[model samples]
Target chain A: MNISEERAQAWRADLRSSMKAKERTEIPRVHMPELDAEYRSHSRLEEVNLGLSAEQAMLEAKRCLDCANPTCMEGCPVGIDIPRFVKNIERGEFLEAAKALKETSALPAVCGRVCPQEKQCEERCMHLKMKKESVAIGHLERFAADYERESGSISVPTVAPANNIKIAAVGSGPAGLAFAGDMAKLGYEVVVFEALHEIGGVLKYGIPEFRLPNDIVDVEIQNLQSMGVHFVTNCVVGKTISIKDLEDDGFKGIFVASGAGLPRFMNIKGENLVGVMSSNEYLTRVNLMDAANPESDTPVFKGKKVAIIGGGNTAMDSVRTARRLGAERALIVYRRSEVEMPARLEEVKHAKEEGIEFWTLHNPIEYIGNEQGRVTHMLLQVMELGEPDASGRRSPIEIPGKTELIEIDEVVVSVGVSPNPLIPQSVEGLEVTKWGTVVVNNDTMQSAVPIIFAGGDIVRGGATVILAMGDGRRAAKAMDEWINKKS
Target chain B: MNKIVSKEYFSANVIKFEVEAPLIAKARKAGHFVMVKVGLKGERIPLTIADADLQKGTITLVVQKMGVSSSKLCALEAGDFITDMVGPLGKATHIENFGTVVCACGGVGTAPMMPIVAALKKAGNRVITVIAARTKDLIILEEQMRINSDEVIVMTDDGSYGNKGLVTNGVESVINREKVDLCVTIGPAIMMKFVSQLTKKYEVPTLASLNTIMVDGTGMCGACRVSVGGKTKFVCVDGPEFDAHLVDFDEMLMRLGGYRDIEREENELYKEALSSK
Candidate 1:
């Protein structure tokens, strides 16, 4: 079928479905997917939701009502044109909606899939005043982005003529990609250096494919490449080429967006056991290297009874991945109650649906190994929530003499990560915090060295993908003004 | 990237690369060391600065091929570059005028001790040097030590070289002959332990350099920790060089053995892959 005819048919379907449109609501309505006949029979990593059909997408879009002064955009970290994109979808211009999103977000497809829109953009929707369902903004956003990709002809933003201004970005994650894209639009020659063999720092390595597919991330990277940004992989800036060397190579400005990749371990007993591993290493082995394949060089251990320790989004992803890896039973061992879990509500719900057992109020004390030197079981201490701590959440206090032994062959530690100290160690005269994170002006991302700027996980230790992209946008603007004034 | 100031081969397994590092070369003294990585995927290994040239802005690193990382580094030629190199880290050696000082070097230890002997002689003290190895083939820096010391002795375990005994044997002979004011030893932990024990009988002050597991080569990681004088100290920032009599050699030896099994397995896997190809 012709492209225009197919779009026209979709528009007709949307118009026919407008007669059954519901009244505006206060709370954002969660979209439920109709189970696929074939996928329900077979379990695989394919996307669970087939996405809202064209008729459903239009009905959801009409529910937006196009607030004159939408506060939803203010809640978005990347400042995506929430109302404008929703308007495009209402008019059946799915291609234009994708373009509106790409104007700000460097990874719309990723954010649409994983971002917690209920807490951010959709939280401030006007429809929520009357306690009715708000528009399904996140689902529609994903539809527009996926439509553009499947169509194979995405509309890219036009770049200005090259101004011969060179800038170097030290990472290839969301922050680095955002800064590079913005700088390239302003006619600056941008080059991104990645320490690993593959690009997309944590996006490609930390998050599992079942949640964020590698190809979806690759498409976003390809879009950036199409905009005249160059990427050099396997080059660690602080080690392979120092900051001073970049300046000497005629890079007038440098934006260090090296995300925090160092894994932090609790100094408890049995932490150094053979079965214990950081989420960073385990996820990297599975996502980047295909370690699940038995024929691969680096095969990851597949345990029959696996226990993942933590309650964040990474914990959810790890537990779900273990289930897909043929583990008969998978569990999440967290110290806090279900209400205090750091994972998004939707993720927690999906994890429960996938048969992942949650052992809340349980903390691992030690891992016991067998005679042959392999983890056979773990000793866990039961706990209960007490008064709120500094983070405004109730802390878990151990209950004496309530320890239990749970048999498990593997344990993936998803506690947290720290900033990599490579950049601060290499650059002299730059001040770094005791945690090894670069110190920068909170307002402007500039460091003690006027020519260098840093942000993202390297600055904040750990943050969401959208927050990192926000820092990138701010650094690009600051850099552009600083360079223009100097000239 | 820094330029190579000088390069020389001390033995089949050891090579000294002198690179230009003005900041380190200026502040470096006898006992300071540096950490280097040959390239990406290379582990950080600590090496003592065998010598320094302030005028030429260079610090020398004498490396012996002991593991995978070091063997890869030893294979590099004169002009080849290392991916990263940092610091004249750890504490500088304590230099003072004791009437007479005896310096002992074993195997690769001769390279680092050459600078201490030279410094001790410059401090107006009588410096006696003893160099030992498993055999004559392993002994290095004999001529360099002779130039820096008032008297020099060479020993080997197999009796293929100077005196047929360990380095501690030479120390016993020197202690029995004269009243040594201070003794400095740099070698394996076991050798240093015995040297400290032998010197305890003669009532002489003994100093030894401790080699510990280090990651960042900075105080931030707290990996290179050791107990000295009944206090825990970070080797990277506190003292890679410490009083041999007060060091807890037993704890250091146990920590070094922690990763033996993993390393052996990795090495075996690496060899099998190489042989198959």
Candidate 2:
């Protein structure tokens, strides 16, 4: 069928689906099966969420009202065709649904697990308007992607004829991977340089195994690799090879996604103590280096009392990881109240179920260390919520003369992170903000250096996986257009 | 992949290897170092570039068997491939003719100091070298130091070498005798601390090369942050070298020993596994 005819037929199918709309609305949202909280918390290697069964996925897919407008697509960062994929699942064409997802998302499996769907697509579900729970869009998306991968019928997206124009990406994180995949499908020779030994930047290091397994990320990377994208590990772009070097080697374009790997620490006293470190260090050691294994070259210090400071997803990951490492008491000490936390509601709920203590409205003022220089205790200031701040969350103000000291052995700081300064400082003439993020045209994601572009945590400072992927996709389109126009 | 072309034993636990890395060798300078990973699971550890031959496209790395990563790196023979090596990291040392420069280094610290000494001598500075170790057998690169330096002084803790005192004693004697313009010290944190103290008392400008813990030697992780002049600085990007007077040695020492207990345990377990095989 021709393009316009195909679109018309799809719209007609959506209209015909109104016949069963009453039955579909009556089908309640399918509850996702999960590993027992107590059992899964201790099992560091096993995934917590047992993916939805095929039957469960189809029933859940039925719950989608298949709205004529499909506001869910507007909520998605990569703008996946929600109705097409959901309807594909409803028809039991699982692989077709995955193919529909792959048309936009480069790492659907990863985003399915880590993305905050409640705040995004699910929130926009039409069922919410009827005072009912939203359709399980995220869960169904995960089922479709997982089913396709496990069935061994993975499909490679079509690629255009080899344009043979060389391009490079600085980091193999979500943003870089997405950019590489899109550029490759456009028939460009793409190369990604990773400073770490492994790919999947934060997905491998910053994230723990129990939440998002390494194998899932590896499969996504393999898909990109099959698309003819090349990866060079242990290569620091600005240091090992300069931006000038890539140009000298005849690369037509470069994408700087060397994420915000620089972890931020609270500049409070005793932060430099032996037992205090960034969440990046703690997670990288356990997840990437196998530091839990005593025989590993670098073993993480297993503490009996661990306190992770912050209210973000990373703080949740750190506190949960500490629990798995045998901490007798694991706590999340956040400056603001639970309502103002930046972590996903699912993560917070899981952490509480795993017996993680929440010391909400408590901020660490100073860390006390023993003579041996290891963290021994934390001095916390009681905080109360005040007027809303710029981020629209209530600001936390310290209560005068109300403080408490708690004994702790280890502390993981998860305040936030600044951009990785390598690319910004190394690439001359590339404009950067006061926060060290590269200045790029919003429409194109192109930096002052016309041949260079940037995205991901390096551009957003700290953001979700899907947002970074969106940046990568946008940059690829802009880079391709710029290259074609120039030639 | 950088291949190990040659390996030589500097001492029982110390080793030196010449690896093939044309880009790193061409870009390297005196204070620049590389992050080397022995195997797929091995952690990346920073090692100073003792020397580099541009023509041969190779760089020399001196390894001391202190932990599992270092021991694994030292066990490899000629032709074994390194899974990963990325570098020419950190800012190069500031070289100039500061007349009468004393280069005090201990044990493995002597390796990173070799290039600085050569650079200083070529810059017309009369370099006085003080090489120290726990005993005579632990000392290394004596002939090379003697060839490049105007004078070489050996100090062993057990009095089995040139002098019977610590490195501080040798460095102090030189300062008392002649006009010492500058001092550069590298080694254990404790040794550098004392050398910095001695140089401060003599009012001589000094530089200490810090070997802090680092994950990605490209300023990604803040594991190698050190307090300098009351401000936080990343050793990977800000420096591997800083003014001795401004460094907080005690804090750096504690941070360096953050993994000491676990390291010792792992090293013992690894040795047991190796011996059983």
Task: Using DockQ, give the best candidate's number.
Answer: 2
lDDT of each: 0.78, 0.90
Per-residue lDDT over A1-487 for candidate 2, one digit per residue giving the tens place of the 0 to 100 score: 4322433566447644655877777888888788898887787788888889988987888788776678888899888888778878877899999998898899989988999999999999888887888888888889889999999999999988999899999999999999998999999999999988899999998888888999999999999999999999878887778999999999999999999857888788988888898898888888888888654576687899999999999999999999989888999999999999999998999999999999999999999998889999999999999999999999999999999999999999999988988788788999988999999998799999999999998889999998999999999999999998999
Off by over 4 Å in 1: A1-63, A90-92, A130-134, A234-242, A288-306, A321-329, A366-377, A407-410, A425-436, B1-277
lDDT of 1 by residue, A112-184 (tens): 8888888888888777775665677788888889889998998777788999999999989889998998998
Clashing pairs in 2: none
Q: Which candidate is the best by TM-score?
A: 2
Per candidate, chain B TM-score? 0.94, 0.98
Alpha-carbon lDDT of model 1: 0.78
* Docking class for candidate 1: incorrect
Q: Where's the lowest-lDDT run of ten residues in candidate 2 chain B?
A: B214-223
- State chain A's TM-score for model 2: 0.97
TM-score of model 1 (CA atoms): 0.70
